[model samples]
Target chain A: MGDEVSSNQQEPEMSQLKPDPIGRTALAVEITNRLRQMILEGVMQPGEKINEKALTTQFGVSRTPLREALKVLAAEGLLELIPHRGAVITRQSEAEIAEVFHVLAALEGLAGELTAQVASDAELAQITAMTEELRQSYAQTDRPRYFRINQAIHQEILAASGNDTLVKSHELLAHRVQRARYQANLTPQRWRAAVEEHEAIAKALAARDAETTSRLMRDHLLQKLTSIRVKS
Target chain B: MGDEVSSNQQEPEMSQLKPDPIGRTALAVEITNRLRQMILEGVMQPGEKINEKALTTQFGVSRTPLREALKVLAAEGLLELIPHRGAVITRQSEAEIAEVFHVLAALEGLAGELTAQVASDAELAQITAMTEELRQSYAQTDRPRYFRINQAIHQEILAASGNDTLVKSHELLAHRVQRARYQANLTPQRWRAAVEEHEAIAKALAARDAETTSRLMRDHLLQKLTSIRVKS
Candidate 1:
């Protein structure tokens, strides 16, 4: 399982595009994505050592690249590295987790405003489709499928915002506050409540009401935070 | 020069507090801070190799600790690690520079709102003092001095907001968009104009006007972006 996970993360193409060029950035990005996935997927438990030698071997690279990858992960708040010891995956305290949600609320609120201001007919239709898909998945009791659609809905809104910088910042915040067990651990009641929140955001978007959409999106995120905080 | 930089960064107390008996987060933090300072101080330029062997020797540590330290630095967006090669500093482009300012404008706008909502008398006074220092620096054409005071004023606002998460997010944005030269190269006339913008923000804060303060802060950042874009 470890081998498969690490092997699939072969360094991004830009790493080899130039001969002996500044490949660290590419390496860092490759590392960042892989680490993010591992944390979110629960492949490596939080606060694991991220064993440099093991990773170097598993990823078919040397310490240099592995270390670089660790750095990138750290930037996203996935991995934490010690000065003299080495790197390990990071774990969030309950308070820190709440902090992440607060930032998420702001970023998503910004994204909602931009999306309402710019979403096209096609985009709105796509969101509507995803919303339906999520509803169907929930009915089928397919947690993973429901979650995927839920994410797609959010991502669609973010992409429609016409602001790449905002999108990237939001992504960073999302990864930092990894939703590892967020939906997986949801009660049926909580799940239904979340779907209702999504519907509110979609309806606001369809109305092209930036104020309502922004407020609804913020409320949606805050609702999740409140749920997660209480449970944590 | 490298040796001097390393010597000054040797913080011994990082070993004293192990928050978790088995965890190494404190170590990661120490390394992160040291590397962040190196990058921010320009001792480590973008795209420079962060050789583990050399770093290990310099700090009188083994590869294990050094690698861990590198991971923390990478996460902070200071280093880029290549799979086969090694870590190097990250470089910014003209477009990226612009994107950063756009994000900064929104973030500072948020900060301004929070600061206005909750500025203590002491905090407001500090901001006023910093603005005065900035004015003095402007009169003397002291760019470095002016920059320090300018940063102090901004930090005071961030601090007054009493949101650690917001402050950290803003710090990340600032670090990611580390283009000091963009502000440094501004013509003296433009610098003075910026100082005047600071005056507006300070006045709004003094009046405890949240809406005006937030609007003026957003405008201040936008003006900076416009000036830099024009110059670039």
Candidate 2:
């Protein structure tokens, strides 16, 4: 493995690299997405130093582009580039985690309020359907499926807000907060409460009750923050 | 002037450039600060292609660091890097501006609520002092001074919130939305109403009324949005 890594570290010409699969997307952007997914999914655990040699070999790219991708991720607050230590996935402190959740609650609440005002019937129907799906996942005790559905529902509402700036801002912080959230094992009572909160949120959306929807969304996120076991 | 411009354009080696006066700050970061100030002050107009060569000459730096600074600013949403066309200062559309203001209102509201809960006496006193200064500026019709003081008061509240993430997020959007705000000329009645709103906000802060303070802050921002004449 060491020999293979060393051989791959020999710099390859830029033209020899495979073309980006997504046309019009820059190579750095494509690399950034792949790295972001790895970090977000915990495949690359927080505080782990990114192995540039392995990553370059895995992606069949040169160091220049890979380093550039790291710079972009660092700028987005997903990674930290220490001068001599290279890049490490950032582990948010408990205080930082709480800070992120507080801001997210405000953003998601605003999204819910705006969606109520501007979402089309079709969009509202889609959110309602997702909520029902999430309910079924809960019933079946499929934690993974429930988590996916819950995220999708929140994302859909943000999209429905029809504000590009809000969506962008929310996604940036949400990406950082998700690692803590995924690790937080919700108790049975808290899980049930969350599901019921979703139900109320969907109902408010259906009724186009902007005030109630926003309030419910904000409170739901704040409640989730309490479930997180913050390390002292 | 042309001769002077040419003289400054004479290429200097990277090593020949002056060391950054801000100790330990990277060249790219210094460049980013200078560029951001230029764009914010309208020294570089919206949609104007960044003249890379001229900027390098002006900054007494090389193209590599200048381009890197442009990339950082682009990431901050203050500039747009068009493929092959070089970078241009971003011009927000009416919808985008409105969207940004809406999110800012939510973030600022959160700041007010949190600040009310946690602000130290000194912090509260500082805010109260800034409010008084702002009131005096309004009475004297010092629009520029009033704008500066208004921003300082808001900054104080965000600082008092004691949430780094909230302050970072609010400042990002606030920086982008400020150009539209500076151009908004408040009518006499609207100006007086704004001062009255600030008075109410100060009173709430003094009373430590979180709900009232949050609502007043949110409403104040939304009202300012109305004063902006969004171009069709």
Candidate 3:
């Protein structure tokens, strides 16, 4: 896993990569985002020890800032810092995975409830558009595209809630279990069910039914957990 | 706030303070915990710039590890690192406070549901005893003591949930709002209502009624938010 991540980074030098569009973001933030993406995308698999030397070489940075980024990710529960071994990608046990999904369901439910109350017509329309895109991905059986659009729709709901703390907390937890979620590709029946669930959630949001929207969102995420075959 | 925190630190010289028990924890973890305690206890006032010099002196550490700890706390939302300004204790707007409480309520609700399902008899007994102690503190009008006991009860509930991810997430959100929560002293009527609510939650947990327990626990925390007058 570490070697794959290292090889994938054989590209133009770090100086050649475009500077952050927002010049305000610090090096640590940029590095943290890159590492988090790699982990979530399974380029750095769960339970794999992070090769600090390789990462430093790949990013063309010293170990100091890279270590700082690892600390930040560790605090976010995406990495675990061992006493002597340094950092490793976090691996959730089956029970932990289930527990995370349960918590995510509640958080998403809160997002749906708040969004219904506060989302503007423009925001709702944006969500509707994302839903349409997700439907097309689903129809095309494009799993990766489906996943990306699905996340965007959920993220939009969180943003529409207008709760920065909620959004931040939700994003942290979402990132922790994202690899598992990415792997839990639905069976065809489950895929159909999920689409139906999304339809109901979108309808509730459109109608501004906070209670129904929250309930549907919560139930929808909870049902997603059932598709994961936790190893005994 | 700076003076108060400094005064609280007058007990011992940095060299005299005991070393970490395990001697294995990274300096960042130790520093993060100490700084987090200062912030959550309101010794370090919200938005106060963390005096890097003083903290480095107090902890007998170099700037490198201290800066790393600040980054970890920043990720945990207990501190914010501004561009060039360095790190300051986080300050949440009133809306952010309310949003945090709402998320806390949901997490606590899920805790109650899981605890009801799996908590050992001894764990439930521990919670009941904590409730009883909380009642005594309320009767004595010991607001600080009451607050401590109240937090302990909630912490115990989260612990009983047996979900590390849930507990970690809850603690992060709880610390972010700890100052506001500490300041939200209940009126006499609200105090009685809170005690009654805790009694109901305890009863439901004892009965192993997951649904009722979760609902009551969530409502109990949400009710606490009402006592807080958010600055408009």
All candidates in order of TM-score, best leading: 3, 2, 1
For candidate 2, lDDT tens digit of each residue in B194-229?
988988898899899999999999999999898885
TM-score, structure 3 vs. true: 0.87
Candidate 1 runs further than 4 Å off: A1-36, A47-68, A85-88, A118-121, A135-142, A180-193, A203-212, B1-94, B116-121, B136-142, B184-193, B196-200, B203-215
Q: Deviation in angstroms for B89 in model 1?
A: 6.8
Per-residue lDDT of model 3, residues B49-111, tens digit only: 777998899999998889899999998888878766677666666777888999999899999
CAPRI class of candidate 3: acceptable
Clashing pairs in 3: none
Q: What's the lDDT for candidate 2?
A: 0.85
Angstrom error of the Cα, residue A171, model 2: value is 0.3
Work out the TM-score per prediction. 0.70, 0.86, 0.87
Q: What's the CA RMSD of model 2 in angstroms?
A: 12.6
The model with the greatest DockQ is: 3
Ranking under lDDT, best-scoring first? 2, 3, 1
> Higher TM-score: candidate 1 or 2?
2
Q: Give the alpha carbon lDDT tens digit for every residue of A120-229 in model 2.
A: 99999999999999999999999999999999999999999999899999999999988888888778888899999999999999999999999999999999999885
Per-model C-alpha lDDT, please? Answer: 0.73, 0.85, 0.84
TM-score of chain B as predicted in candidate 3: 0.84
Off by over 4 Å in 3: A1-24, A230-232, B1-21, B230-232
